[model samples]
Target: MNPPVPLAKLLPVPKDLTGRLALAGGGLFLGQWFLGDLLHVPGGGLGVLLTGAGVWWLSRGSTPPRFQEPASLQGWIARCREVLDQFETLEPDGGVRRQQLDAVVQRSGPQRLALVCVDPATCPQQGELEQALAGAAPLTLSVARPLASAEGARTWPTVLQEQELILFSLAAPLLAEDLLWIQQLPEDQPTWLLVRSTAGESDRHCSESLLAQLPARWVDRVLVQRPDGLLRDVLQPLRRQLGAPIRNLQDTRQRLLRGLHQQWQADLEQVRRRRFQALQQRTQWIVAASVLASPLPSLDLLAVAVANGLMLREMGTLWGTDLQPDVLREAAGQLARAALAQGVVEWSSQMLLGLAKLDGGSWLVAGTMQAISAAYLTRVVGRSMADWLALNAGVDALDLERLKREAPVLVAKAAEQERLDWGGFMKQSQQWLLHATS
Candidate 1:
């Protein structure tokens, strides 16, 4: 299989050197003819220059915004690394890497610690627990008894509000009230659950059960205490769970930044796709406009055939297909025939006349009508080509007879669903034409 075309390659304005020179020269000659022949201008050379400049301006204006490649996952990771390096530089003494409990105490400034016990007898005494918690900043430790009674329930909320760090020691299965109390706790507060399974139960089961009962957001960390291990062992796991032991604020902010970058990348890709689709549609309209401007019979049809063929080929690149020229030509011819059979010329002409009346100009009426009709026909052709490409997989599999039969329905549907926005379409086409010349 062929490698997919990069979006950068797929989206740049079409390049046709011969066509560009032809248009520029034609525009210059026509400009002189109109100014010198019709309006009796004094200087023919100046008229030529002005016409060339106008053509250049129109092509430049029609050109789409420069394409930007989406940021890769590696790029995002590198950005994150840069941010981490900055954090490290700010705190050379490892101030940002402090333990979770220590960081909380330092940041919150001398706050109380509330330790809850499901079974009061199994929990360590306040003094012994306080001794284990002792570090650079001493914390005032208090034990909150389980919500076994109405009085216990009333005291739990007060204890939670008074403390910065609330640790729950599960020595028994949590009751409904215990789960409810944990759920009701303010999500902003840092709460930890330390599971100390009973003799008859499995520690993992107890941990899983307690986690399932409590809201995941309500608990900041879940620590599993080894039945025979030191309290210090639980501290390391707590720090890891907290993500940043030294600076919880900085750690949380870093995570949010990473998430924002990921979202931004996704959003950027979506915007690129939308813009490409709009450009693709505008290019089709430009071809139609060119066809409408032609006064000779069969010339507009020929333009439509050639323009739609090139448009389809470009679209094929987008769809990851390398369409053959013969296939594209045949497909274009089928679509052009369908447009003629469906009376698209008459319908589009009528629609253009309606638009011209709204603008109010007799001289512009014919040109405008032709331009819009071409746009309408080209739009129908593009849509049909897109459908054929999707259904048949490539131009090779296109059924010209079937496409001919289906073309009129597709045109009518597109006409009803999409109203012509000529102002923007014309502006884009002019820019594209000018860009091609340059």
Candidate 2:
């Protein structure tokens, strides 16, 4: 017998029919010449013809069919169909299946593929599913574990980053923490939960429980695989589900930021309100002290008006409104005038005298009455500005008469909450008074 031809040479046939026919005829002629002339065999030409025909048939059978590179969604689907056809011939093994999946991903260009094994021990069709997925396609498979523990929770974000398509196998009931962790994952991640029914529980009951725990918007698709069914039965549906490309990480980040923005806005409002209150108290004390130190009565009102205007503008900013300086000044003037007209100045003097008596009368001095009056007016104006800002921002509503009545009560409540630092207030008042006069 002639030396055996190389296995590689025999495997792949030529693309065109003409090339295949020529190869077959050439092989027949060579075989006939070798057997008939050299070996002197009877019916050598027919034997050689039969041998050549057999070789041609085997070459045709072994040759891998050529496929065009997919450039569109439909083309990609066609390519997937071709891969599925090839998968039909592969044996169900991990290595073989992994290689096949890698091929598909490579062709598709570093795509993410999630292999969700629902209770792998109970699901006998996992091996078949893995084998069916193995092809020349480029894909990265991430086997997700239940995030019930701290260690398992750490793996959650890593899986999201590494895999594009998450194949989740839901064989058991999800815990509250697990459901929470899954909900926290990027909303754009295309997740397909492969839910397999168990013998202990009814399928409908189990599916309903799972559905209730999971956010409807977060899950892209829910595929139910029966315990009696084959894994390959759902392969076609899986392919159809993966037809759409995975959403980009940037898009996922944007969506996450948007979701958090509303919460952040609320937190920021709380911080602003706290800051506004603290600053308002401090500003009132400074304005009161400055007015007390001022020799002119007109300068006392001017200092209070300036301090109140600045404080009101800041309050407006905290409430998400940009109040014009003129508007703030007008509001401050109205509140300051109302406080003076309501005899708040006389009441404040009597309160301060009592407070001074409690403090060993060190605060009882020549301009103490004017300082008390100015301080009271400052507190009233600040409280009014806060209420007006709240009203403008739709947080609260109050008419002028109601606001005027509430002003003294709010100021008194604020004073009761925290003691005034008399020494510090006097020092701050002196500095502010000096600055204003200069």
The lDDT values for all models are 0.51, 0.51
**Which prediction has the highest TM-score against the true structure?**
2
Task: For residues 1-438, write the lDDT of model 2, one tens digit per residue.
Answer: 243342223322345787678657755764464334432334424466664664354234221122233334444334343333333322223344335334434443355665544234533344566675655254555555434446554335543544556766656566454455566556656666777776667657766777777777734366666776566665556665444444333333333333233333344445556777687767777776775676643344446556665677767666655445545554454454344334455455555566668877454453544554566556656666665555444222323334335544444444333236454545655565455447
Stretches of candidate 1 off by over 4 Å are 1-276, 279-282, 288-299, 358-363, 394-405, 420-438
Instruction: Report lDDT (Cα) of residue 369, candidate 2.
Output: 48
Could you tell me which 10 consecutive residues in candidate 1 have the lowest summed lDDT? 61-70
Give candidate 2's error at residue 342 in angstroms: 17
Candidate 2 local lDDT, residue 95: 47
Q: Against the true structure, what is each candidate's TM-score? A: 0.32, 0.41
RMSD of 1: 17.4
